[model samples]
Target: MRDDEDLPFVAALYASVRAEELAATGLPEAQQRAFLDQQHRAQHAHYRAHYPTAEWLILEIGGTPIGRLYLDEWKREFRVVDISLVAASRGQGIGGAVLADIIAAAKAAGKGVSIHVEKHNPARRLYERLGFVLAEDKGVYDLMEWDMARPSDQGASEP
Candidate 1:
């Protein structure tokens, strides 16, 4: 996200993403709100501290912010720190298109792309459709990776 100006929206987006899980906790409404805000702050701070070089971007359509996409490009791979859209925007093709673009760019650069996704996140299906294979099983989360063969690596006719 750009600055303090974007925090409120981002925090709300974060809360929305966690709403389902939070509801399962059966916490009081006010406690849930406070917990969500605290969790959002902690997650934001953690991302900033750990992914210093990542690009923090707000996804917008017609100048209205709808989501966030944070990416960290390393020497041999691009790490998707996080990508999320508002409830109204989920299941739309916006996310698929965004992932396709990122995959294409990774293909062009001969670098792999990776992201950690919750074990049961519905988005796992989308990632699988995009050719991301499970790379690591981290208990609650799985690391998914996508790689494209470079031009030089695609041919084996010459012995």
Candidate 2:
């Protein structure tokens, strides 16, 4: 991210990710915004502390910020620490395209890509379509993995 300059936009993106869940709480708009801001800070700190070497990138288009991708490379796998897109940019194949690039890169490196996805996340379908499989069930989150070593319905290295 662009540090302080992108703080507000990134926080807003984080809030958008939880907008539906927070809306269900019936909290007033201001309260929801405050809570989401706090949660976003916490998440940012957690990821920074845990994945100190991870690439924290801002997805941009025409010099405008649209999303963020946090990825960590390990010896055997690439961990998608988190990926979030602004509300307006979602459901338009941007995310899928980004993930396909990630998959392709991992395949080239002879490593697997893995992400922890919420069980009900709509993106899970996209991951599945791209050949990610359930590697583990961690309560609310499912760990999905894609490895070039495995046979994929989507031909290997087609990303």
Candidate 3:
């Protein structure tokens, strides 16, 4: 997604997810905005720093961008700051395909790619199918890693 066009959408998405949709759940507008604003600045800064040598990507289904993946190459090991597909697009293999593409792209760059999935998300299966393993936990998120060129992945391929 073009930052120019999707920044607002992305910002909204970030706000909604970070607040678990408090904006639409009768929470005060001011409080909702504050929660979202706090997350956006922190996440944006993290993305910028890690993205200096990496790639930022968005996945579209039809004409709508349904997912996003940010690969961090500024560090020795690659990492994904975020990966999300629209809720309505879930369970239709879009997440897998988008992540598969990200994996291929990161592997081509010769880095072990890692992603953090929220504890309550259901995408863990897709990640496991792609050979990503649990690396650690951050209270509310599970950090996972995938080494595409590793021996354990000798027979792995995008589904």
Provide the lowest-lDDT 10-residue window in model 3.
150-159
User: Tens digits of per-residue lDDT for model 1 on 1-159?
Assistant: 546688888999999999999999999999999999999999999999999999988999999998999999999999999999998888877887788778778888889999999998988878877778889999999999987642222211111
- What lDDT does the true structure give each of the candidates? 0.85, 0.86, 0.69
Runs with alpha carbons beyond 4 Å of true place in candidate 1? 149-159
lDDT: which is higher, 1 or 2? 2
Judge candidate 1 at residue 133 and give its lDDT.
Answer: 87
Q: Could you arrange the candidates by TM-score from highest to lowest?
A: 2, 1, 3
**TM-scores of all candidate predictions against the true structure:** 0.91, 0.91, 0.71
- How good is model 1 by TM-score? 0.91
Model 3 agreement with the true structure over 106-143: per-residue lDDT tens digits:
77777677888878766776777778888898898989
Taking the tens digit of each residue's C-alpha lDDT, what string does model 2 give over 1-159? 635577778788898899999999999999999999999999889888899889888899899999999999999999999988887788888888888888888988999999999999888877888889999999999999998866356632222
